[model samples]
Target: MNSLSNQSRVTYSGTGRRKSSIARVRLIPGSGKLIINGLPGESYLQFSPNYLRISYAPLRTLGLSTEYDIHVKTKGGGLTGQADAIRLGIARALCNINPENRSTLKSEGYLTRDPRVKERRKYGLRKARKAPQYSKR
Candidate 1:
């Protein structure tokens, strides 16, 4: 059995932010297993499955064939936000793994944080852009 200490590896750290959430991730070469806050798959399921899939999609799409074990600690956001943060962390880590691939990753816009978000609702409004009941009377 291969022990973690015995393996030759490079460590990469990245911070991802989305909405009110932030995710910190560490990537190291190993078998593909995502460890979020020291817990494995079970912990990941705490978040929405679609978000998890979206977050991990980049790794495969980018052709990062090297097996990696990812450790992520995310806080302060909803499931969607956390997923986006996770995606950003993975993209950054991939770039660290290979500087030459920066162009590829950058072109995909994985490095940029999505700036769009919900606007604050006004006191009299039901939602950000929605107005209160209009009366002709």
Candidate 2:
């Protein structure tokens, strides 16, 4: 049975993006382990319950939160972007595992790549849309 078990070890990968963040995620058949950038998921996302929830939303939706292991490498943006990117990555990977998951994930908006990003700073503006204090004299 060892050979049979070995044959069942499948790995799936997907790329996800949110704002300026990008994440490369992999899913492997294992017991619900999550590793992010060489650290455990919870540790990496410490003090942010919302971020942790976003990262695991897809798996929880499919009732597979404890069926597969997730490994992620992400960069750019802030904690929220990274978490959202990871969530999308996991959803895409799940679709790769079974195409039937596509509709469900799509309906729940997990497979959709959030298109909103940081706006560019105009040449004369102090920020994206804020200008320096006006001089009316």
Best by TM-score: 2
Q: What TM-score would candidate 1 get against the native?
A: 0.78
Across residues 9-97, which tens digit of lDDT does each residue of candidate 1 receive? 67788888999889998888788788886778446657567876867766877766357888899888787888889889888888887
Task: Give a tens-digit lDDT track for model 2, residues 1-137.
Answer: 99998788889999999999999999998899889999999999985889988999999999999999999999999898999999999999999999999999999999999899889999999999999999999
State each model's C-alpha RMSD to the native: 3.8, 2.6
Q: What is the lDDT of residue 16 in candidate 1?
A: 89
Clashes of each: 0, 0
Candidate 2's C-alpha runs over 4 A off are 1-8
Among residues 3 or more apart in sequence or in different chains, the pairs in candidate 2 whose N, CA or C atoms overlap within 3 Å are none
TM values, all candidates: 0.78, 0.91
